[model samples]
Target chain A: MKRKITLKQIAKELDVSISTVSKALRNSVEISEDTRLKVQAFAKLYNYRPNNIALSLKNRKSNTIGIIIPEIVHHFFSKVITGIELVANKRGYNVIVGLSNESFDKEVINMQMLANGSIDGFILSIAKETLQQQDYHHFKETINQGMPIVMFDRVINEIPCDKVIVDDVRGSRKAVEKLINNGCKTIGIITTKDYVSVGKLRTQGYLEALEDHKIEAESSLILKVDDKLLSENHLESLENEISNLFETNPKIDGIFAVNELYAVTAIKVARKFGLEIPKSLQVISFTDGVLSKHSMPSLTTVSQHGQKIGEKAADLLINRLEQEEAIEEGEEVFETVVIETELIERESTK
Target chain B: MKRKITLKQIAKELDVSISTVSKALRNSVEISEDTRLKVQAFAKLYNYRPNNIALSLKNRKSNTIGIIIPEIVHHFFSKVITGIELVANKRGYNVIVGLSNESFDKEVINMQMLANGSIDGFILSIAKETLQQQDYHHFKETINQGMPIVMFDRVINEIPCDKVIVDDVRGSRKAVEKLINNGCKTIGIITTKDYVSVGKLRTQGYLEALEDHKIEAESSLILKVDDKLLSENHLESLENEISNLFETNPKIDGIFAVNELYAVTAIKVARKFGLEIPKSLQVISFTDGVLSKHSMPSLTTVSQHGQKIGEKAADLLINRLEQEEAIEEGEEVFETVVIETELIERESTK
Candidate 1:
């Protein structure tokens, strides 16, 4: 029922450096007998067990980092990988990528496979299934075993580790505000179900923007698309759902989509209904990916700068891996770095 | 310089199983004295030196397969990875992906890094720079060191190994023939330079299609885009080049692009010239990726089935890895699998 205590926490409470605590716990002759006994007693009281994997860290140095992502076909995840590799390779570390296909079991299997002395650490994004199930034992177990993990983009707060994320709420708010600035009297927003962290944050931002503009948020104009619609087989149904939204709300003059697919789909459906883009229905979307750039009347978008996020995540992970010198153990500090997003203006907006 | 002989070749020449030849060469007591002498003499005659890494293979049983790719952001490569992971995970193997970023040095480094007891074998796509430089020493050296390799998509025939490829020439011919069947005259084909094997084959297919139709291939209508044009900073120049082709050959009614980017770019340029898709200017491209599907007119394309290629490549590599019962060394056979392509009709063409 209680949170697991770490070596850093024990060291901090004892007013000792992490290495001194480690040496004391290991009963190194370099540490005095009195200090060793005290450290061991403290460790036992807190049910602290030395990480199994950490004990072998000194013997195996692969100089390689493993990255496990939810999906390989995604534009944002790929960019993050490119960024991670650029930094990792330059720092004399090779990167090994594993795809979980958005499954919780696959995610756990990949982490375990990589952790078998093949990689020094990991940089990962949580899978949707894992998030939906609210299960993070795999992440906690890996960290407990002394392998550092730096999560990015799709991360859960339940795990105690470093994270790098974009300001999704702020980015979405800016997009909605831009639509309002374009003199749109009525607006619509399309997003994924609330289980997706980024989608939920973006949806909240949409509501906040409406409130700020004194425009009552219309529930009818907000569509929470089923994730299944994003797959290749259900594209027609996806179009139908978006089409139904437009047919039901004829006065919705502007749109904000949490991701590129929805934004492009809305454009296609709007054009089908004989609506002219920019002139009749301006739109803004998240993720400045290939779709946003290549879509006709190229989309105006909130660019997540995925590569930068990758770079930050890799830096956080590699720094932890190379921190041979034990920390001051001041509450075992963890960082959650937020990379700012940029609104890229294009032909889809006035 | 003479080519180094492999264990399979030695085994074949000695008329023994590959395992027997291996055991004999290692001076195992299980092999009869006569057989050991015969295998050893045959190996020495062919100047066979046991691969350094192969000797250590027995000590390391990391059930992970390493894959090195040219670019991770590419749609084709990503799909290939997805397929590979699906098959590998199912077969109780884990895939570790390494990106070469199309650099020859990075390719060599990634291979070397993985070969140091981190993985059982490698599945790789050769980097463009490696092919352009015509330096395959790294591949030859790796193979000589007794590690099995399975190359996919962009591969070199000089390396004696298993390969999985689409029928590029056939696929291209089909796409071009389809455009010709629609009564397109003065067709333009946008492609990469001849150094890229896929583009070169596709371009040859276009030429063959024109020859079959009794239409002399117009050199002016064929645009061999510089590889640099694909980068973000030079995309405008790429567009300009395509526009110039249209400007000079106003009567060109169809376009067969070797890849999705060129096909989509052509559509954008055609629209700029007030040409309507399908009705006035038909387009067909290779690679049924996101861009092809989501483009305004939805491109008609030759589906390469990248995932299938990945699956086949993984099967080939894993089989080699698990071939503990060495073959009856009659001959070391290698297979080049050609996965068929299908032309999917969409709005870009009639």
Candidate 2:
């Protein structure tokens, strides 16, 4: 069976704006008879039934914004939602969240479901799977259909939309530099495999920090954990991997983890080895979440300020959605906003 | 400024189903001529222009479910979302989430926005503020309008809908009994005020455990902490309140906290007073979340199995949505499913 065509395809095929195609479909007097007939003939030829026409045709504002994230049980993503809600609610827009669970198919499905008139616009973070697959057609299709999308956190450069991101490279560098300044001779870094955008950037930051300090980076000191470590079933292996890092590198006095879980796990393993924190093994991780604040000795962390990123994303999407002229003209101007991260000191760091 | 008349209000006034009113307004042959004319006359009297008709008239399935929770930056809630997404995606349904931020107004607004043709059904936890106000009209209105709602976790008995909850009282009682079995003489309880259903039930469990053990319950040992303590702004005050409980009850050898935050906070305070966990002060709290597992000494807790609750709630809501026979008959069969909780033993308790 052939895939159902959309107004976007018809508009592109007929060499007319989406709004003009929409008007012609409704036989609006605003469009000339010749243009209306041409658009209608094209739509008919393609068997375009306008499956989601009700979403666009509804005059009453849904006044709700949809946010799609890769995961819900994540510290940074949750904080971003909180921030987005704060701004969206204040501006008379309700926010709905969709979790992709790090699957590319789920991400595309969520966008399609939300874009079908359930929400006025979308604010989202790309899933790890989506980024790795490098398939951005879903995003392009949604944007082409005249729905505003603002991406945050795990965003890709290929998508031409407003984005909010923390400088992962700089944030990681600052965290690693802190460990260096605390008089560490050797430092180990725990991070995800390079397929993840943030993990790659954070690893880069670690490498840059070591080079800046004139310390030769040891490949063995960097442990690239598999993404499966995120699931509960893989936690034991994650702990084992970190333990091997400690056991293999007995001289490693400092560690930097890309996220909170890895950092906390490192501390747990360090304690098992009878190493005292701060005094014996100073550690710093990214994301100042509940685990960071309440862990034993509490964790020294690089706070990505997730809420600020959320607020910035909301502002961009809402601004775009409310601009009638931009919608009419189908403006393609996009922006990438970077929020600053702060390094937090705690008992885990001297 | 007259209040806009909704299909719900018209259905109530006309003593007909919302579907009937919707059909008559659209001049559908599904309604008899006499009934249609009568409905049309009533609608005209109320100046109903059917503002959200597009939402109701569209026969196509949205294939989406909406979930509203009090907060997102919470371990329990996030886990619940994970479970819901797992079940929802497997069932070919997409999930959308809204955060109430524990506010009554936001909760009502979110429901209204989602109900306006955005989602097929809802699985939600009540906002703290909504429970405090005892206002459940939005819930009643949605149910009346032929929408299915499945309440979970922070649910109330007032609403007649499907519910998924853990036996909070029994869970708490088991935790307290474990503390008593560890040979504690005086046990202090840290919980929220009585308005919160979970807190009240957990407190009752604490009392029942003491009563079952033939130990007299001391009113002074019970510290009803303000709910605001959950936020970072009031953490210092929360710490002070728990400290006072410790200072005032010098004989207190065990503690039972209703939530993970309170339990971890108690551990922090107990350490400040030079008290060793499991040896000097045995402790157990409800909800085995991230903080409990990674906290110093690793807390013993009542595991609520949040994922199970989410899965059950989603099943209930989705089942109701897909049952065309039930919708046609306006069936009101409601089931309250109680999930069991487990007592997890850790180093914080003997």
Candidate 3:
């Protein structure tokens, strides 16, 4: 309430060195009992708070982490942010969030802004554009500067860092196996772009599973939609694509949409064609969301365990940050944390 | 290549003031052209960077805003956050996110942490627990300390601040009016705890609409679920509640769920009872999410324009921060923006 007090003033009042006062204020064990007690009392009297940034400069640890997310509007990424914050906050680390807006340039700039002593490390999910570009020199630069990074979903394979990812491939494979088990032989795959590592992995897993079930993977049955084709006018293009796929391969009895949005779209397209779900065209999808639960037949899906993925990713990054000194040389593969994707059989697959 | 140089060190070497160097570094037009050129040459030569945090402190503006969201995993809040970030980032403000995890204490602690010069101001949606408690003295304290707060969605009526909110009452009323127009006499409501301001407003709006249509509002038709019930055994309790509501009020031909989750649940329960959506019982809900889009009949909803709300809130706060003087005194109302809701007529209501 009175004049603002500084560590120098406290040091003078206590007749001790500035470092000793600073150390005592930080609760350092190096300060003696009497000095610590006096310094603590004086600090309490003045309500002294050491400048965090200045202290960080001296210690060379910012105690802050930067997080780059593709989009906060997405439920999956938002859950991941929650997980990261829970762990980071518990460990007394502040988190700075930057949105890439699915742009590579934005993502790079976001990383560059905090690369110099602003943040100790980074935890990120790559933007769709960044995945498409496949240039990870910005991440590499941070690694060269001895900063730890932990990547979650939508990660790049080229960058060497600690990674926390869901077993998308395995999850997709399991979905295909389930479809085959349910007497669905000709499965139609509805997906948007193969640019992402996750997308590629999911597609490959689908193919592998089909092969294992003695079903030849047909390229014509794969109905691919570009990311740009989600707009209003693009709906016609999507409808045409679906119609063409059906025309070419009329035996398709099952459909698997890689993402939930596309899955819902698949359901709509199927309905337009007067396809009776489960009876005529069984529907299965990757990544569970609100839409899947509400879809006409209440979509059967391979749940990605979004919350778990987020929690695990946060745990991995915080764990690495805590053990920064003893961190290993190579990339820490977090087991691809294959949290089993449960088949939530609702009306769609019944 | 030699040693990393700082702004202060460079200022000393060039015999120029630190303020001048800082202004030049930012390319501020306040400095002379020759001096600015010299500062730029030296800064580039030595790779000098003034500490962003320290500079921010000196200017009394951090170019950062603290955002406390209840839960980002929810689509509505996630969309709101995305909107806030889009506007804030474009205006050159970094957003620091904190998840309240729906706890009052955690929310209070986050407010306290950011109050002490950590961020320029705060943008928040009250936690569910906070709404239930209705205590906002901590927020008042921050405001008293000259920190601006812009609250969106879940906001307290008592707190005098800039607020961005959806017209829940009006939206609900219009929804019921539409149901009435569709030939529904008896309407039931499924909602979260009535303690939240939004929930109460929606219920009131429903009552108003029912009265307007000459339909009697019955207490037996309302089902209120608390947080504990929500976290543990929601589906079972909700299912039981819906069955009981229908049994007691068998004449009920319409249902209004105050949120997307409840709306989705209503669709599931309706299907179990062999009731055709929109044909036998017209259904409408608030808070458009992935679930609503995927619900069996594809729900007709009172879409709370979260993106618009978020953008408006961010703009309000940024405007206040950018202007040297206060914009307005006493609760700056953002005019409860009522974005039109579309009735997505699918199998349920069509």
Candidate 4:
């Protein structure tokens, strides 16, 4: 087998120090441009490439960002990751992914494991349980150790770091207001994440929208479903819950489902109960998935642009890393970007 | 900030050479167990973590794997990723993802970018275009460079690497036989990926099932919907094609959709024509997404066990990596695991 060419071979041929050859390849200003070009030409001829590990060792930066997401099945997080990868790749960095499965302990352990110089920085969407428990010391310790972090989506406001978030409250409020303007009176809300900050904010928006229109917020109309019930046996509990929802409120004129799955279920359940969509119940939901665009009535949704969110978060982290000057040690709040939530009126809501 | 303790600090305090301290930390067999314990204890006390990049340089292993997926928004790929992350995390490996977006050029570029010592191995599910083109050179080069490759789901038969795949042929066959048993004489197969290997196999299965039931395979009943129409906002084209499908085969009593999204559309189109599910037109599909489980008259589908496929692929890759001796230079074909896809009797096909 032919031996692979090493940086030492280029150095030996050039009659220069190995460090000089390395510097030239890196296009370091310390090396003369003529010498750099000469070294680069020779390296190219021999197909000589410096070991990335060796380079990372000398620099103490891997040019890689670690991203931990709770789940990737959802369209919102998936687009966010695509956006992050797009920016990270363009900026000459790689992204490593860790799935927390929405476990707080797993999130902490992942952070601790990646903290040992595996990446230059971290861009994370905290798990649901992590936000609920308020256990953010692991993230705090990482920041304290001089590692930069940028949190997105399910983030804890308490942790002092750069944060890029969707204005969930505003988006929800806008959704509710739009439904109200379309003459939906008794708007019923379905949310699985009542404990998490984003979920709470969205619910708050629902209440605020109701108050803005002088409609009383009824506790009975607010449905709080847990993740366990959602995951167990293919929507058996969800079907039952939807059945009860209709049974309890035959007079309900509109529905606002917080997630795509719930919106789909609402559409299905409403259809089964002989409620004519748009005419009987105007449905508007959060987090558009494939189902929303293809359901029987072809759902109306508030599309959370996942790709844009991911891109913004990556840009923030990469920018911070590239900036040579030390940033002030405090929570840097990135304005919660409200990507326009276009109410996609389809057969269900038209 | 206080200077963090380094390897130099531990070595100086222990009166040991830096190399010996490093070796001891690695629990090298050359070092006595007493020295190992002492080094570990001191390292723990000082929180001395050997730089990850430095260790990678010495070992020539990144402990990071590159995962190239077609798209994350899809349920099968997302769930498979969840399973892969589960195993990869346990084994102390981090995965970096690259989206191929179902483009051959993108897949090739992703392979080229990761080939330069960025990852220890590559785990991929080939893009539809890649399969259609029958391209294997990009994959071949990675293997030649001694980088392990594991392909899953939409895999190539010729690629000499570890693979994880579900028996699409058998699954489709089973679905058809079940529909036939339900007393449906005329069946329509909806597929967008007629060029890929999996699509071909599944189509064959459908034909075989028809032949077994002594039903003629009618060319007109085989709806070859364009792949781009499935994902793109070309709803009009799809609606026209779906309308044409029903028109071509007015006696089409059952529909077997190759994917869940298409199946959901079939349900929608059928409803637009005022056809009742199961009683008038039975429907079944593959890759159980939320749409399948939650659609009105909830769909019956052939469940592709994504997590199991992921687990199998990871196990195969790790087994090869950990083998005491060098691997033989031919494709190690892990049996195409035929995870039995049961007929999920639901409201639609009941």
Candidate 5:
């Protein structure tokens, strides 16, 4: 069987990164001269074809939209896809999905595979590793090839493309303000590390709300948990971390978490400490997922309306595709539509 | 600005189902002669080309696997994808996903789009509508065209392909027997209608377990919920239905639900009735999802090992694809690999 060489294979054979091989193949300036030359020679030997999006887009229409999500077992992404499908079907286009699994190389690989004449445009969330590495070159290369992309949720500010995002900071601020108004004195926050854009923005909202109320911010009350420890299957670490937070901040009267799982887990841990919800500690989380709605005592939270974001993203991509000819002859304008978030009050709050 | 006409469009343009249009295109006698001729003529007029899978296979190897799932927002399906991706990545094959959204026409259209030289073979779970319609010409046609397929979870037995499934009957019987062993006198069951094969099998297991224990089965105790009434966002109907079950049978001491949502909801309703879990009432559900773990009082449920099913399905498909040359030269063998299920005890069961 004569299998075509892929960037992943080349990287494995030459003991380099997929990004390095991709850059070297494109003759990027960032790659070292020796590595680039070696990479080029190996690719040539294996007869590697990079699945050129530009050349493939020169003729024919697939009329399919490709969406790359960071993870598959996520509620928000699933809702977004449901929204995208409802609109795409009405607009006479089909949708396909690729998973990046939060890896930088996988993200690049999936984009290349989907862009290889399989789809007309893309709707994607930035992968965690790509954001951490601050690598936007693959995205720029695909757009340069004349394929339209609409990014949603986890988007980059510098990317010159249409984006649909929820007002993360404002939503978080609303949750914090609600807690303050309910007579919460010492509020604590459970959030992700600063690298994740949404988590960082949400943390900023908490800080801003505290400053507005003239409450002294305490570092001891803030718990920045590792995202890896937050998987639904193994939540012992998450529970232990929240337990430690309660142990250290005995005066904490309110809690704001970046997601529902953390908020629900905190409630479970709080029960061990014999603190009654709403009366002793009020809790709010971001993303109105199933956990918040189904958990005992429920939870007050922020609703991102993921489906609306997905619908808007599909419309933007399809509109851009239809206007490609006219846009080629005129100046291009990209829009960022912010989907407003709402706060839902439940038993966790006063 | 030209676009290829799809079966979905042909069906819409004419007043026929997508399945009818598909059959008419392939000259299946099942379609009425008048409808067949009209469909063929319309397809011809619009330059619609049914993706020729075998013809594409002769010239190239895309080395990509296409997986069509019934729904994306499901935990079991998501876990399966994670498992498939893990092994597929290790084995050097990439995966692309198409969603059917539980519709028959969308499943046909997605298969056509993916089969159009984008992927080498398919791994899919049948859509709900397709199962109800009982029109499996699409799978047969694809197989006849020299394309291999691997089915998982909700699969049909007649399809000559590799399959991965859990022992639904055995798993359900185990859950019921556990409840019985805990000294529950009168037991009830919550399941889907007979149209869904897994639900039917689980119900059968419940009945068999009752029969083996010399307990008379009561028709009043069986609550077959409409699948449409079970969406997470709108739980009022589901709650009402479960509440009715409890009201009708005040002496019910045990319950076995086919899925986690129903089991968790039953517990919630049981709480409303002031019945304590594991004492006055015991509950068990199938499919160990986050709800089973996170719900107050948790749940004792059947674990299908969805990731394991996915891994097995991928291995089967890749093995068959790699051995196509040998398979064609010699005898072909199809497999149905059954993944075993285990019961995880939690707060819901004593």
Candidate 6:
């Protein structure tokens, strides 16, 4: 769908910073008269619509921060929420949560419900359905109406806002490299469909590591799991798919799964195939969940530090909310923070 | 804290139901004029304050439900929240969550923040600290101010409102009975301090089960872990405590732990003592969490069915809220629903 040019785009065309374009469009006293007039003319030419940030800021502050997550029964999201709660409570701000359940409509409804004078700003992770649809009109409308949003984990590059994200590519690359250093020849990856940004990045990292070691990437060794298997009700199907991967590739020696459920399921399937873990089959997954620590042979994992991501996201949002209060209307600068992931080795890998 | 007599107390004194007293106090058309005068005179004599239900209901509806959980990183609570979200969304209501982190002060603050006209009703589980302190003024104030509350899991029996709770005593008794039937002698129990109502009831059930089976209840076999060990940061201390339990009672062949964390820790400690699971030692836990399902020797658990509990609580709260709308002022009737627990047999038990 065609959309109006954003402040970032207007600034890029006029060879100025986004802040300058914003000030010029709003006719701020800080902007030089010549640059202001030129920027305004260019913005008009492109039919740019100014964000009503000032109008939102004028509304009564709720002293509460809203967080919308994709799932509530997930450990990673839970840890992030705990971290946000800790920071929010300490800073005299209360935290409230909304679950999108990975639906685009729910995400939009949740945001509108909380943003309707219930919270000062938002700290959220994008829903999988939203990412897949590529429809960000609701998010755009909220931002345009002057409400600030700080996104974490799953974010859109096109949405100009503060974001905190894990280095998924580097994290998964390290997991694959660890398997390589342990002398595993046949490496397999169990991941989600490419629409999930993290899964896509992790898949990319697995390919890059194989390329770095001059190993040929084979389609037969990779399994893109259908998300329906994640419901835990269809864990049998997930196991069957993994079993198929092993059956098709008898030489499979190493595995990297994107999440805990997939990693543990892979282990169960490997054991059924009479393969001893860390001896014949080495495995690693990206998320450090409880299942990874307590599984039969345990699992090696890339720790995304969900708590740190939440803390950083909360800090960024609260800082912006407070800064806007102090400076009234100033230059709008957004920051994208990349949180480093760590590899935690356990019995799964040799 | 000294408090004003409630409608419940007046009803109890006058040998009438709580709803009758509530109706009479409000001088409702449904109540007989004589009964209304008698109830009103008694209320005046006792300095009773009528709940501001009408005033609260008169305000614009937020169409949002507020849920305050003691902890956010718990699997049971997470499942419960998922159930609440499922029902709330379908009923055209949005759900928001607040974490008290088991702190009384935080619980009060969360209630106050959400109660400030942000939500129509609340569904909460009591915090550990609030239970310890026995300070219920916050809850009383909210109820008095006329917002409906639905409580689940950890709830106060004294609080008169809708409640959905697992049959803790019966559930724990069944868990103990399972060990007895498994042909294991010298059964041990890992539980929490008695300040927590659930823990107290669970301990009582343990004693009752032993008595019913003609086995002597040994005080030495019971280990009440400090609440601090639940932080996960102090997991080492929890393991050490379980280790000491085994070292001092080497004859302990069976164990019933109140929660998944304690049960998993027991398994780890037993392994260190060179005891194989379900071979020499059998264990059963109350909560069926992720740890129980994925542990090396998967645990046998009495499932509390948290999601079912949440769904019930949501239905009860929403029903009352909607019912109130039909009748401008009506008799208030509260309910307590008990969700049954099921025993899931796994590798940990014979």
Q: Which has the greatest DockQ?
A: 4
lDDT of 2 by residue, A1-350 (tens): 12346788899988889999999999999999999999999887764555432554455445678889888777788999889988987897777677887888988877766665557889988888878788889898777666778988777887788999999999999999999999998999999988788899999999999999999999899999986436666778888999999999999999999988899889989988998999999999989999998877899999999999999999998898788434567536899999999999998999
Question: What ranges in model 1 sit over 4 Å off?
Answer: A1-58, A228-232, A324-330, B1-58, B324-330
Q: Write the per-residue lDDT of candidate 1 for residues A1-350, one digit (tens) a residue.
A: 12235679998999998998989988899999988999999988865654322333444555778899998898999999999988897787877778888888989888877765567789999888888999999897777656789999888887899999999999999999999999998999999889999899999989999899999998899999888434666778778989999999999899999988889999999998889999999999999999999879899999999999999999998888777335533355689999999999999999
lDDT of each: 0.85, 0.85, 0.77, 0.80, 0.85, 0.85
Each model's DockQ score: 0.16, 0.18, 0.37, 0.47, 0.11, 0.15
Please tell me which model should have the higher DockQ, number 5 or number 6: 6
List the candidate 4 regions with Cα displacement exceeding 4 Å: A1-5, A9-49, A228-234, A271-273, A325-340, B1-5, B12-46, B228-231, B324-338
Kindly list the interface RMSD, in angstroms, of each predicted candidate in the order they appear.
18.0, 12.0, 4.6, 3.2, 9.7, 18.3
Model 3 ranges with Cα > 4 A deviation: A1-60, A234-236, A325-346, B1-5, B8-50, B324-350
Evaluate candidate 5 and give its CAPRI docking class based on DockQ.
incorrect
By summed lDDT, the worst window of 10 consecutive residues in model 1 chain B runs over B51-60
Model 2 residue B82 distance off true place after TM-score fit, in angstroms: 2.5
Task: Kindly report which residue stretches of model 2 are placed more than 4 angstroms away from their true locations once superposed.
Answer: A1-56, A60-64, A229-231, A324-327, B1-56, B60-63, B229-231, B324-327
Write candidate 1's Cα lDDT for B33-106 as tens digits.
Answer: 99999998988775465532233234444567889999888899999999998898889777777888888998
Candidate 3 lDDT over B129-200, as tens digits, reads 877788788798777666778888777767777888887888899888888888887889987677787888
lDDT at residue A38 of model 4 (Cα atoms): 100
Winner on DockQ between 1 and 3 is: 3
Chain A accuracy of model 3 expressed as TM-score: 0.85
Candidate 4 C-alpha lDDT tens digits along B272-331? 777789899999997787778777778898898787777777766766666613655555
| Chain A accuracy as TM-score for every candidate | 0.82, 0.82, 0.85, 0.90, 0.82, 0.82
**Residue A249, model 2, lDDT:** 95
Order the candidates by TM-score, highest first.
Answer: 4, 3, 1, 2, 5, 6
